[model samples]
Each structure stands twice: as structure tokens, then as C-alpha cells.
Target chain A: MSSQDYWKANLKLLSVLLFVWFIISFGFGIIFSEFLDQFSLGGFKLGFWFAQQGSIYGFVILIFVYVIAMHFLEKKIGIKEEENE
Target chain B: MSSQLLTYIFVGLSFATYIAIAIWSRASSTNEFYVAGKGVNPIANGMATAADWMSAASFISMAGLISFLGKDGAVYLMGWTGGYVLLALLLAPYLRKFGQYTVPDFIGTRYYSKTARLVAVLCLIFISFTYVAGQMRGVGIVFSRFLEVEIQVGVIIGMIVVFFYAVLGGMKGITYTQVAQYCVMIFAYLVPAIFISILITGNPIPQLGFGDTLVNSSTYLLDKLDQLSIDLGFSAYTENTKSNIDIFCITAALMFGTAGLPHVIVRFFTVPRVSDARKSAGYALVFIAFLYTTAPAVAAFSRVNFIESIQEKSYLDSPDWFKNWENIGLIAWQDKNDDGLINYSAGKPFEGSRPIFSDEFGSQGQREIKNLPTLDNSNEVYIDRDIMVLANPEIAKLPAWLWL
Candidate 1:
């Protein structure tokens, strides 16, 4: 892939991941928290759990996913900063 | 051993270990001083990042803050950790790839203007000083409460130790010592959480135990806490009563703000490769999540125990833990109805949260706090929310030294 293709692929990965981030943190934790709280997980209501606990767990997992995805992308396309001569 | 003695020995030992690490890792070159010679292992850098990012507020006060805020506390949890995601993916690797030592340097070259670099430096200075000032106060609280030293003496002691390592080791020194700090700090944070979780819910893991049913009872811990809160005229524990917008703004600010801290960004440069920088952030969040996940559990457990122990209990007959924290002034009982029993109800017990102390003592031998009570609720007790986590050992009757 050309450097531009590599950049485009990188943006796509980021967009998908950040969208998931927004849904979990903002969508579930805040906007729809009360609606979602109708369900329960273990001792916590679903929304409250996401607010205090689950969103945090989701964030950690998401970062690792980014790391793995990016590592593979780097290998396949090699966007590792090149020196211009 | 006594709690005081344990604090002395453990605190002394940790300081000595930090100083030793600083000496051993002294920067041999300019590169080492700036970013550990840009050769740090990814995992070690990640651990050090966790230690550096958490701050005194995270260590000493976060659990207490979450306990008080209840559902509202998620703003902090999400904001801080989510900020890391932004940092690793969008910011850190790019900064590392540029091979710059600090944010100002990166801005200076990228923007091709010294003015932009100066602006970055100014912002960094402003943010760092305020952050450090709050941190010193937290250090003071731990020293005064745990070690029985004056807050001033404690702060100076803290500064001297920090100065020694920071000056001597540079970034390499700070990095290694910080890794050691991550171990000690997390151990301290987790032990009390585990103890309290098991004591209340019969589960050893605080994360799961937070959602587990209370020991020998069918009700969930969160459900029990919610009921206990309402029965005492306070809001339900699991309810998110704050406006959704308020929560969103705070969480967004924190998430983006996490990537903004220049100090944290510097950690990315410490690693060898751009990929290493990204993986290092993932690792940092794992260590951070260990504490963040447990905080709400600590919050709920401590809230349940706090309300149960103090609500409607007469002042003189109250547990030693209640009086011990009260004596430190983080807790107070104002009997507006002339009743001797404690009732921690909704709303601030005083006009502002601060209590004005008179020289006179109450009938129950509690200090006479003459602050005009707010007439909003029939509540007759003033309990500072910060005491919940620190006093959890005493509340649960767990033997001391668990935290130390």
C-alpha cells in the first residue's frame, strides 16, 4: 500500500474504535443510562454498572484492541515514520 | 504491630527503596535525563506511566470521592481511563515518532514558531503547579493521619524524598522508581478493597464482590445500599440523579484532558518504538483499571458500612472509628434537635460544608460545632465524605496494618 492508503486505513480503524468508545462511555453510561438500568448485571443495574465499572473495563480492552490492530497494520503497510531525503 | 508503628516502618522502607533506585538509575547522559535514553522496556514504561499518572489524589482520595458521588462518580472513572485511549492511539505514537523530549519542543518545530512553543510551556507550567499544590495537601493528609506528623513536616519530608530522586535519577531514575511505586501503591490500594469486599459481601474479589449479594442475605450489595440510603432520607445509591449533560461534559473533559497532560505524553517517548509506545499505554490502562474498577466497590461497601454504623447511633455509644475520624475533624455531629443520636441524612448539615467550632463541648462530649445548621432536612449529623475509605478498616473492625 502507498503511504496515503496506509493513512486512510489508519483513519478507518480509529473511527470505528472511537465510535465504540463514544457508545460505551457516552451512549450507555450517560445518555441511555436510565433506560438501560432496567436490566441488571450481577448486583449492579446495567446502566449504573456501565457508568461506574463496565465503561472502564471496555476502555482498557479497546486500547489493547487498537494496539493489536495497529501492530498488524504496521507490519502489512509499514507506516513506521520514514525519513525524507 | 500498632498502626502507627507499621506506618513508620513501611513508609520509611518505601522511601529508602525509592532513594536507592534513584541512585542506581542516575542518568549518565542528556538523553537519559529526558526520556530514559529512549530505550525503556514497554512493560516497565507502562507500569511507570500508571504510577506517574495516578497522582496523590488518585492514591489517597479517589475512593473517598467515588464513595461520596455514588453513580455520579463514573465521570471520573470514564474520563481518566478513556483519556488514555485517546493518548495511545492519536497522540503518543505520533509524538514518539517525532523524537521530541517535550511538548513545547514538538510544537516549536512542527509549527515552525518559537511563540507556539512558548505558549505550550506556559500552559504546562500553569497546569502543573496547581496539580502539585493539590498533591502536596493529599500527602499532608496521609502523613498527619497515618504517621501522626504535622502536615507541614510531612510535606517537607515528602518534598525532600521526591527532590532527591527526581534530581538525581532524571527521567530514567524517575521511571524505575515509579515502577517500584506502582507495585507498592497498587498493593496498598487493593488490600483494603479486598478486605472490605470480603467482609461485607463474602467475595474476595472486589470487582465481582461489588455486584455480589451481601453475606447471608439475598439482596445485592448495590440494592442494599440503595435501600439503606433512601430509608435514611438520602438518594438511592445506584440512581444517576445528576443531569446527563453535566456527566457528559465532565467525562469528555477528563477523557480529552488525559491526553493533554504533558507529563503523561512524555512517558510515550521513553519507549523504543512507536508500536511500543502504543502497547505501553494499553499496559498502563490495565494497571490503572485494577484500581478504578475496585473504587466503586470500595465506595459502595464503605457507604453501606458508614450509614449502618452511624445512623441513629447515640454519640457516646458510637464506634471508635467514628470518633477517631471525627476527632481529626473530617466528621462531626451537630444535634439541632438536642438528640444525642447521629443521623447522616441528605443535604449539607451546615450552611456551607465547613463547621465553626466553639470552645464548648456538647452533652455527649462531642465538640460543640456552632455552625448554623441548614434547615433543608431533619438530618442532625455532619460527616465528611472523605473519611469513608480511610476509616473503612476501623468501620469493619479489620485489624490495622492492612493498608500499610
Candidate 2:
């Protein structure tokens, strides 16, 4: 990939991951929390669960996914750190 | 051993460990002082970063805040942790690639403006000083409660201990000491939670224990909590009390603020590679999630346990824990209508008439009872929410070993 293509791919990846983040934290966790609470998970309402623990778990998973995805992307684009050195 | 003696021994030993680490890891040059010689393992840096990020407020007030806020407390849980996502995705790798010693350094060179650098420095100083003041106050609170000294004396002792290690070892010393602190703080936070979880829900793992059925009851834990809250005239535990707009604003602001915090961002600079910086953020969240997840469990269990143990009891018949907290001015009770019963509820005091409690009267016990709008004049209990977590074990009657 050219340098411009590499940068574009990176930005696209960020946007996708960030979109998931926004939905989990602000969307389900807050705006639709009451609606989600109509369902139950164990003793927790689905919405309440999303707000308290689900969003946090989602964040942790999201970051690691970004890390792994970026590692693969770097190799495919021939922009790995070793190549630069 | 007596609890006070145990406290002295544990606190003294932790202080010694910190000072010893300072001596062993003393920084001889600016590189070591600023960035731990840039040789720290990602895992070790992650633990240190976790320790640095989990400040006094996280340690002392977070669970207490959550316990009172109920479902509304999700703002903090999501806000604080969600910011790490922003940091990892948007800032950490790029800042690591930039390879600067400080945030201002990165901003100055990137923006190409000396004026921008100076402004960044000023903003950094202001934010750091305000944050340090809260941390110092947290130190004093822990000392005064555990060591039995006045808050001022506790603060002085804390300053002296910090000066020895922080001034001597700089970032190098702090990094190692923080790893140790992470162990102690997490242990201190988790042990009681495990014990309480087992006591209330018959499960040792607090996360699962929170959802488990209450001991000796068929009802699930959250169901019991919702009922208890309503019985006490408080909102249901699972109900959302905050407006969607307010919650969104607060959570978003905290997420952005956590990502932008200077101290937290600086932790990325200590790692060896940009890749390691990414992994370090992941590992740090893992460590932080251990406490963040458990804290809600602690809050839920404590709120349920407190109501079961204390509600509807007469002041004269209250437990020793209640009296102990009262001595510290954290719990108060007045008979109001001369009925001698404590009525805890969620509405405005005396229907918003604001009857001054005896403590607020200040040497004149002549406040008119008739002027207060209380139903039967029995609205006289004031309990500071900070006491909720610290007093949890005592209220639950957990073993003394977990008290520390």
C-alpha cells in the first residue's frame, strides 16, 4: 500500500472501533438504558448491566481488538516498524 | 492482635517498603528520573500505570459514591474506564511514536509555538495542583481513621513519607513503588468484598455474587436491593434516576478528560515500544477493571447489608458501629418528635424547611421544634456517605482481619 492508502486504512479502522465504543457507552449505557432494563441478565436489568459493567467490558475488549487489528494491518501494508528501521 | 496495633504495623511496614524501593531504585540521571530508563517491561509499566491512575478518589470515595447513586453511579464506572479506550485508540500510540519526555514537549514541537508550550505548562500545573490536594486529603483521611491521629498530623506524616521516596527516586522510584501499592490497594479493596459477598450472597467472587440469590432468601440480590430501596423511600437500585442528557454529558466529559489527563498520558512514555504502549493500556485496564467491577458489587452488597442491619431500629438500640461513626460526626440522630425512633428516607428534610440538627445548632439548643415541617418532627438523622464503605465491614460484622 502507498503511504496515503495506509493512513486511510488506519483512519477507517479507528472510526469503526470508535463507533462501537460510542454505541456501547453512550447509546446503550445511557440513552437506551431504560428500554434495555425491560430485559434481565441474572439479577441485573440489561440496560443497567450495560451501564455498570457491560460498557466497561466492551471498552477493554475494544482496545485489545484495535491492538491486534493494527498489528495485522501494519504487516499487510508493509509499514511494520522493522521496515522503517 | 488489636486492630489499632495491626494498623500501625501494616502502615509502618508499607511505608518502609516504599522507602526501601526508593533507595533501591534511585535515579542518577534525568532519563531514569523522567522515564524509568525506558527499559520497563510492558506488564510492569501497566501495573504502575494502573496504580498512578487509581488515585485517592478511586480508592476512598468511588465505592461510597456508587453505593448512594445506585444505577446513577454507572456514569463513573463507564466514564472512568471508557476514557482508557479513547487513550488507547487515539492518543497512546501516537504519543509513544512521538517519543517525548513530557506532554508539553510534544505539544510545543508539534504545534511549533513557544507560546503554546508555556500555556500548556500553566494548564498542567493548575490541574496537577488541584488533583494533588485531593490525594493529600485522602491520605489524611486514611491515616486519621486507621492510625488514630488528627487529620493534620496524618497529612504531615504522609508528606514526610512521600518526600523521602518521591523526591529521592523521581519517576524511577515511583514506578516500582506503585507496583507494590497496586498489590496492597487491590488486596485491601478486594478481601472485604469477597468476605461480604460470601456473607450476603453465599458466593466468594463478588462479581457473580452480586447477581446471586441472597443467603436464606429465594429472591435474587438485585431484586432484594430494589425492594429494600423502595421500603426506605429511596429509588429502586436498577431504576435510572438521572436524565439521559445529564448522564450522557457527564460520561462523555469524563471519558475525554481521562484520555487527556497529563499524568495518565505520561505513563505511556515509560514503555519501550509504541506497540508495548498499546498493550500497556490494555493490561492497565485489566488491573483497573478488577477493582472497578468489584466496586459495584461492594456498593450493592453494602447498601443491602446496611438497610437490613440498621433500618427501623431505635437510636438507643443501635449497634456499636453506629455509635462509633457518630463519635466521628459521620452519623447523627435526634428523636425529633420525642418518639426515640430513627426514620431514614429519601425526601427533603422536613419537607424542605431545613431544620438544623443539634450539631449545627452550635452551643444554643433552643431551635423551635414547631417551626420545622417534619411529620411528627422525627427527621433528625444525618449520615455522611463517605462512612458507607469504611463502615461496611463493621455493619456486616465481618472478621477483623479484613478490616485493614
Candidate 3:
């Protein structure tokens, strides 16, 4: 419930979110792309999907998840703006 | 069978969809017009933000730039998208919590000085206009090629279309309409990528095609491209040729600039909660990456296709695609070897001042024309690399539907 605790929780979430970001962009884009490309889904190779569409889709989903996660965190940490009755 | 007709149909469809969305979601109040009543769903906001962020530069220009730059071009890839990290961590949440209608409002309020607000406005106007000029140029090119109209007419049409809804919807109108634009732009971008990837690598995804070995060749596609580039006096395609200092500075500037951009920063303000702003920043990057990641693939595939298939071939022997782009002044060459074939070279700008004529006035003012080098340098004129993306689908002989 303390300010310190709220900061800790948000930082944790951000770190995790950034990890996913790295996996999609750097992992699939440059490093592990060749290995991933050996696999195919639909008409797209895995690496190609990650580069062109998948990473982007993952990014959108992550942000929305962060929003929902923040709501719970806000309630726990006492920063929730009062909803209009 | 009808490439020209298909372009008209697709462009017409996109225009219709955008206008319909604008009319249906027309903003009644300044608040609604600017921020969509501050009630947009986060996912929808993400899509709208993506459209707003991508611009004509991303949709139409980046690939062409990358195709030419080869590995040195990663600055754009890393510079443009990496800024979202700064936005999410440093800027978006605070701006959202403060909650303002415009970026200038935030700077004015946060810094707590009216001078700051005025300065912010001036900076915003300058940056926005610079970017808008690029978009207007892009629209003119797209219109001129696809519709067989003059570039001036195309520019006028684009300005009118953008003005109609931009003025009517304000921010709110722009937001909703942007979501539709995002769909059109992404589809226009990806469909061609998918087809080209298949044609070249037998891989449907472009990102993988970069790493995948060429479809029938023993060499990896990237390796093959690097070889082709070296053969033609270009640095290897995948090698980093830029100074690390230049790369570092450009990357940092692009990251900060992306975060600093007034329009992108404004998108976060529309969200209802501080957390939503952070989330939206992340979402916006994801949406943007769709185009960003695919662009390199488009550039690489098209580059290999052009060099291997079109460049240096005789005028009579060149594919129909080359002749078409050449006529539009988008592609050009000279047989430098005098072998009756195009020999590509980077040409220098001529030393004399040639007058440029403007359509707005028969003789508005005399602006010195800089005759930059063309791709083939046969004529001593330069072809701007931006033309590549616009002309690529045509040059690659992809189906007409892919052009839209």
C-alpha cells in the first residue's frame, strides 16, 4: 500500500514488458530469425511473421495488458482516480 | 489486366472509407473534435495512433531508403521504433496523468510559463509543417503515377481530402479517421510484401526471407543481395558502412525526436488514465512495428529483384516495368560503358543554375534547379531513392491489386 511498494510493482511490470519487446524485435528480427524462419505458420515464416506483423500485434496486446494491470496496481497502491457516480 | 483501373478502384475505395468514417464520427464539440470525447477504447486508440504515427514516410518511403542504404539503414529501424521505450518509461504516463488537449498545453502547464507555451507552439508548427510537406509530396507522386494525372493536380486533391476531415473532425475526427487510414495503409503495404516474398524466397513472410536462402540459389538471400551490391560498386547490402558516431547520434536523435513529436505525444493525452497512456505508448509502437519490420524486407527483396533482373539490361531488353518507371522520371539510366546498356553510377549535381518552373504561377520566382544524379547516372541526374517504394511493385511486376 505504500508509495515504495507501488513503484516497485510498476517497475517490475515494465521490466517484464520490455523483455517481451526484446524477444520480438531483436530476437526474431536479427538474432534467432534464421532458426525461426524454418518454421511456417499460415503463409508466413515465423521470423517474417514476427518482423512484419506478430511483433506489432504483440506490442499492441502488451500495452492493453499494461493498462489493465495498472488499474489493479493503482487500486492496490491508492492512485486510482475516483470514478464518477 | 487493367493496372491503371485497379489503382483507381483501390484509391477510390480508401477515400470513400475515410470520408464515411469522418462523417459518421464527426465531432460536435472542440473536445470531441480534438480528443474524441476522451472515451476512445484503448485498442481503437492504438490503431488510430498507429495510423497517425506511420505517416506517408513510413508507408511509402522507408523501404526505398533502406533498399539503397543496405545495412547502414538500420538507424531508421532502431531509431524510429526505439523511441517508444522512452515514451512509455519517461513521458507518456506523466503527460497522461496531467491530461491536456494539446502538447503545447502540456509544455506550457508543466513548465508553468506562458513563454514556454508559445515556444512550444512555434516548434510544433515548424516540425509538423516539415513532415506535412513530405506527406504532400508523397500524395502527389502516388496520384500522378496511379491516376495518370499531373503531380500538381495530385497534390491539390490530396490537400483537399486531408483538409476536409482534418478540419471537420479536429483531433477526434483525425483519430477515428486515422484508424481507417491505418487499415488502408497497412493493407497496401503488406499485400505487396507477401507477394514479393513468395516470388523471391518461396517464403510468404518477408522478415524470414531476409535470412532464408534465396529460393533456388545456393546463397542466402541476404548474402546474395550483399554480393550483388558489391558487384555494382555499392557496399555490401548487410554490412554496416556508416561511422558508429553517425549511427549513434542519428539513433538518439530519432528516438528523442519520436518522443518529442507533438502529434504522437498528443495521442497519449486522449487516454482516460495515466496507466492507459503508458499502455497506449506501448501499443502504438507495436502497431508501428508492423510497417517498420516489413519495410526492410520489402527493401531487400526489391533491391535484389531490381539489380538482378532490371539494371544494366538494354533499353529494348529491359522489362516493361523499367520503361514504365523511366517514363515517369522515377527510374533512369545511361550506358556508361557504351555497350548499349545502362551503367549505374552515383552522379554529382551540375554546377550551373537551372530555373525550376512552378505550376502555381507561370513564373512565380526563379529557384535554382539542382540536377542530382540518377540511379544509372547515364544522364548525369540523380533519382531520389524515395521513388523506389512507389515504383517497386510495378517494377517487380506484382499484380495490380498489390499497388493499392
- Candidate 1 or 2, higher TM-score? 1
TM-score of every candidate relative to the true structure: 0.96, 0.92, 0.83
Clash pairs detected, candidate 1: none
DockQ, all candidates in order: 0.60, 0.60, 0.20
lDDT per residue as tens, model 3, B208-283:
6666776787667876777778776778676556765665577668768987888888887777766667777776
User: In model 1, how large is the Cα lDDT of residue A72?
Assistant: 88
Supply the TM-score for candidate 1: 0.96
Candidate 2 whole-model C-alpha lDDT, 0 to 1: 0.82
- Displacement of the residue A82 alpha carbon in candidate 2, Å: 7.5
Worst 10 residues of 2 chain A by lDDT: A76-85
For residues A1-85, write the lDDT of model 1, one tens digit per residue.
8788889999999999999999999999999999999999977899999999889889898999999998888888855543210
After superposing candidate 1 on the true structure, give the runs of residues whose Cα lies further than 4 Å from its correct spot.
A78-85, B149-153
Write the residue-wise lDDT of candidate 1 on B1-404 in tens digits.
67677778888899899999999999999889999888899899999999998868777677788877789988989999999989988999899888889999999999999999999999999988988887887776666677566558768877766777789999999999999999998888789889888999999999999999999999898888888888877688788768999999999998998889888899988888888889999999999999889888888888888888888889989998777666666677888777888877887788876776787888999988878887888777777655566777778778776755
Give lDDT tens digits, candidate 3, residues A3-82: 98888988999899878866765566445655786787644456545544465556556666776788888887777563
Arrange candidates by lDDT, descending: 1, 2, 3
**DockQ: the better of candidates 1 and 3:** 1
Lowest summed lDDT window (length 10), candidate 3 chain B: B359-368
For residue B27, give model 1's deviation from the true position in Å: 1.7
